[model samples]
Target: MEVEGLSVVYKRARDRAGAPDAAAVRDVSFSLPAGQTLALVGESGSGKSSVAMAILSYLPAGARREARVLRLGPHDLLAAGEGDLRRLRGRRIAAVYQNPGMALNPSLSIGRQVAEILEVHLSLPRAEALRETERLLGEVQIREPRAVMDLFAHQISGGMQQRVSIAMAMALEPALIVLDEPTTALDVTVQRQTMDLLADLQRRRGTSYLLITHDIHLASVHAHEIAVMRAGEIVETGTYAQLRDDARHPYTRQLLGSVLAKDPRPEARPGAPAILKVEGLEHGFSKAKRGRPAVEDVSLVIKAGETLGLVGESGSGKTTIGKLICGIHDRQAGAIELNGRALPTQFDRRGPSDRGAIRMVFQSPDATLNPAHTIGAILRRALAIAGAGDPKAEAAALMERVRLPAALESRRPAELSGGQKQRVAIARAFASSPRLVVLDEPTSALDASVQKEILALLVELQKERTVGYLLITHDLDVVAEMAHHVAVLKAGRIVETGATRRILSAPEHGYTRELLASRLVPPAATAPARPGAARDAPWSAVSQLA
Candidate 1:
């Protein structure tokens, strides 16, 4: 596959007359050789997805694309009609999206979904397709393929859903697969397993890959070549070693610098009073599901101005513990104390002061922010709920404190950038001047640079307000940089707990070791080598060894 001088522009109806139309992708060019990977690394809005859409001829309506040369195998993507592109898409070219839960049909059984792909693409009969679907699921390392076939997507784990999506994509053995932030939503261990599966599949099938992501470290580990993009253009392109050792572009250097930089903020003052504490926490979604409590005897503490990171894989109860602390979920058995006072188990039972003092920020601001209301309105409402003296003035001050411009106050969340929206969320969380905040995977969806900025802001705010933080995330790098202490969770149990540096540098638990090993280390810190060679093994073999 090859592309040259590719440019894409979104024709917005709001554009002023005679104004210059900015292109989302400006003169982007790259080539992917068979059986190799080319990673497009950039921040959000950097046009990596635009390039993918252009290649697949899947751009949205009102979007215009042009290229001097665009060729995929023998077909000219530029010249291909909708019918031609449709046929080529699932047969020779395929795509795996960021969130498999959204990609897979929640209403359909996993078996039927994968079987339908086989039936449509390969013209197999229902029986043959169903049989093939099971084989494909097994190939992707999903256990009890037959059992999974009967279950819907919602019944399965996120990692399984992703594997099902990949199984569909791999059904026809496509020549080029576009992985658009494929593993971003997964936990570290699951992410490593997923990537390893992809690598092994590529090795066996000799399929080329176009990996689009904001993580330069991930690109360095997985791709044969790396392209750094910023503001819709490729600023630098080279092997990881070349770019890491000598990055000519300042943006490229900035991106590298932002990858898990050591937290420079002063440590929390020694002997600071404990702001939040949990003891003997236990919660279960269903008593019928024996031996698997959602949260089992979880316990941790956070002092004023300090962060306690809870690290684990999906379904390890990190978020469950956060919800329990925030009073969003009622714990079956536990004691939660804020400033030495026992808190209610349910959010509705909590007093106004209790509610105001313990706030939570979610992973996606898009889900939390109201589209119909302005940023000022959102902040003001939060302030009003907290019974602030003056909502209007406090709203503006909150925006300013979060480093957002006052002009954005009148704009709705849809009008703000992702980072800006997150800042607004943070500001709202602080509206009550809470003593503690439960941050649940707050920066997982953001780009590396934006993530660093957000973390820095959190540190600054913690220092200023002396607020304690319960940081729940799957990224160990984040734990290394943000947390003063760490707790490792597996199967809904705390397996290890210690200082951040000690847990990351020398973990005692096998699960913690696996999580650390899976994280993508910056190229400068590790020996120059590709990850594919080491990871090129069938998932069955790897899982058995585990």
Candidate 2:
């Protein structure tokens, strides 16, 4: 596949006179050789996805595509007719999207979905397609493919759903695969495993890959040639070593620097008092078929002006534990004490003062925030609930704390970017001036550079307010950087607990070691020297979120 001088522009629904029309991707050029991977790296809105969509002829309506030359094999992609492109898409070139939840049909069985792909592209009989679907599932390392095929999308785990998505993409075994941020939402261990599966398949089948992501570390490890994109243009393109050792562009250097730097703040503040404590924490969902507790025997403490990092894989009870302490879930058997006073198991039983003392910043800001309400209105509501004087004054102060412009208070959640929305969520949490805040994957949805800014703001807030944070996340590098102490959770229990540095440098548990080993940054000594090199990075920045 080869592309030169490719450009794309989206026609506005209602364009006025003198309105500037900007191309999403402009004059981009690259060649993805057969049996090799080319990764396009950039932040969100950098046009990486636009280029991929253009190559697949999957651009949305109202988007115009232009290119000097865009060829796959002997065919010109830009000039291909709709019918030809449709036939070529699944039979010759395929794509795997980012979110399996959104990609998969919830109402359809996993087996039916995968089999449908085979049936449509290959025109195989239903029985033959079903059999092939099982084979594809097995190839992707999905355990008990026959049983899994009968389950719905919601019935399976996130990692499993992602594998199913990959299996669907590989149904026809196309010549090229466009993987757009395939493992961005997965846990570190799962992400590594999925990548390993892709690499193994590529080796065996010689399928070329065009990986589009914001993770520089992942691009360095998996891509044969790395293209650093900025504002729809390719700023630099070279091998991982060439870009890593000597980045020519300023943006590339900035990306490299952000990936390299870990924990800008000092570690371990001595002699701080415990602000929040949990004793004999135990809870389980009644409807759980596996019978394992969602949270079991979990005990930890968050000291004032410090962070307690809770790290684990998805379904390992990290978020469950956070929700339990923050009054979102009732504890089955445990004591949650905030500053020497015990908190009610249910939030409704707690008094206004008790409720105001402990706050939570959820993983997805869009879920917590109302689209209809302005930022100021959300902040004012929280202040009113806390019985704070002057909602308007407090809202302004909260916005200032989060480093958001005061004028943004009038805008609704839809008006803000992902980063800005997150800051609003943070500000809302701090409206009550809580002593302890439960930060549940606060930076997970943000871009790398924006993640840095949010982290810096969080640390700065900690410095000013001496607030304690219960940081629940699957990201170990974040634990190392932000948390003073770390607790590793698995199957609703603590696998390891100690100082962040001690746990990271020399983890006693095998799972802990595996988690660290699964980081996305490749080591220097064993770096691959070939164009089609395949390796892994140290456990660090995987995608947009550094």
Candidate 3:
């Protein structure tokens, strides 16, 4: 399969009148070698995902995509009929998305889904399909293939689901597979394993890959060729070493320099005792039927003005543990102590004192905030809850702390960008001058420059008063920036714990090493959506939901 001078584009609202014309992707020309991966690296919306979506024949619900030429070997892609495209889809080209849980059908067992794909694309009998499915699952390194196949998508861990997605894509053994942020949701070790698996597959099957991601390190490690896109154009295309050694674009340089290399807070002056402590922390979901613990036997301590970094992959129980601490979820077992006093596990059961003393800033800033709630209301709610200051004064002060405009309080949460929402969350988290703040993926959603600003803000906050942070995140760079103490969590267990410098710079566990390797920050990476593209692209009625 090969593509030459391939250009694909789309308009979000072609179906509606007065809708602006937005070109999602444009003038993107590249080739797919028989076995090598041509990675498209860029920030979000850089058209890297757009290119993959186009190649998959799955543009957003409504978008006008124009491609000069989309060819698979001797066959013309853009010209293929619906039936012809369908025939070639699973049999010739398969896609492995970033979130496999969302992609997989929840009601069906893993074995059934894999078998169905095989039956559809390979025309195999059900019994033979089941046998092949087990082999496929085993090939992806899923332990107890029989058990995994019997379980539904909701029953399996995120890493296993991702591996199953890879297996499904490879079941038919397509010539091309597009991996869209394939390892974005996993811990460092899981990410490394997935990358290795993809590389190994390419070596054996000679399948071509089009990897779309923002992690320059992942691209450098896995891809044979790299395309740096900005706005809707390719700014540079070469080997990772080529771009790394002598990058030419300012945007590229910014990405490379934005690493925010980590060192423990130099002005470290330790004070205060344990700000928060949990003994035998355990929790799980289930009231109607039998259930298993998501987080079991978890215990940790955080000192005043220190950051306790809890690092783990998706579904590693890191977020669950943070939620348990934050009062979002009820703790099934264990004692949560704040300032040496035990607090109620349930959020609603917790008294006003608990609410005021321990606060939480959630992971998904967008999801945590209400679209209709104005920034003022968000901050004011905290002020009102804790009765900290005059509502108006506190609102104004909070905005100032987050470096946001005071007037934005009138605007709803939807009006703010990812970075802005995060600041707003931080402002609200600190509204009552809480003793301890649980920051989950605080800087994951922000741009590199914006991340620097947020990290610097945290430093200022720590210096101003006694505040502790239980920062649960998958980002290693962030751990380096803000964490004083670090605890690595894997599969609901703390595998390693030490000072931030010791754990991150020189990891002892194999899992820690893999995370570091997968997380090596590259000085530069490709651009997204081509450089200088309008942030607000032409709108279509069929915009992406969530």
- List, residue by residue over 1-546, the lDDT tens digit for candidate 2: 888788899875564556767689888887777888888988888999999999998889889899888899988887789999989987889988999999999999999999998888788999999999999999999989999999999999889989998898888889999999999899999999998899889999989899998888788778777888888888887777877788788998887766634442356478988989999999988864577788998899889998889999998999888888878898999899999989999988998877888889888899999999999999999898888889989888889878899889899998798899999998888888889999999988776777778877888888899999989988876776688888999889999998887888889999999999987765373566332554342111111211
**Number of clashes in model 2?**
6
- For candidate 1, what is the TM-score? 0.92
lDDT tens readout by residue for model 1, 235-258: 888778778888888999999888
After aligning candidate 1 to the native by TM-score, how far in Å is the CA of 398 from where it should be?
A: 2.1
Clashes of each: 0, 6, 19
Candidate 2, run of 10 with poorest lDDT? 537-546
TM-score result, candidate 3: 0.86
lDDT of 2 at 306: 89
lDDT of 3: 0.78
Q: Could you tell me how far off, in angstroms, the CA of residue 453 lies in candidate 2 after the best superposition?
A: 1.6
Task: Give a tens-digit lDDT track for model 3, residues 1-546.
Answer: 444444555554545667766666666677765776777877766778878877777877656566666787666888898898899887889999988999999989999999999898789999999999999998888999988989999988778989999999999888999999998777666777888888777778988888988766567667766777777677777666666778877777766566676566442456668888988998877666455477888999998888889998877799898888888888888998988888887888878878877878876788888788888887888799878659888789879977998778899887677778889988888887888888888876565666777888987897687688898988888888888888888878788888888886789998877677776544334532212222243211111111
Runs of candidate 3 with Cα error greater than 4 angstroms are: 1-19, 260-267, 280-297, 313-316, 332-334, 349-353, 388-397, 405-410, 445-453, 490-496, 505-546
Question: lDDT per model, in order?
Answer: 0.88, 0.85, 0.78
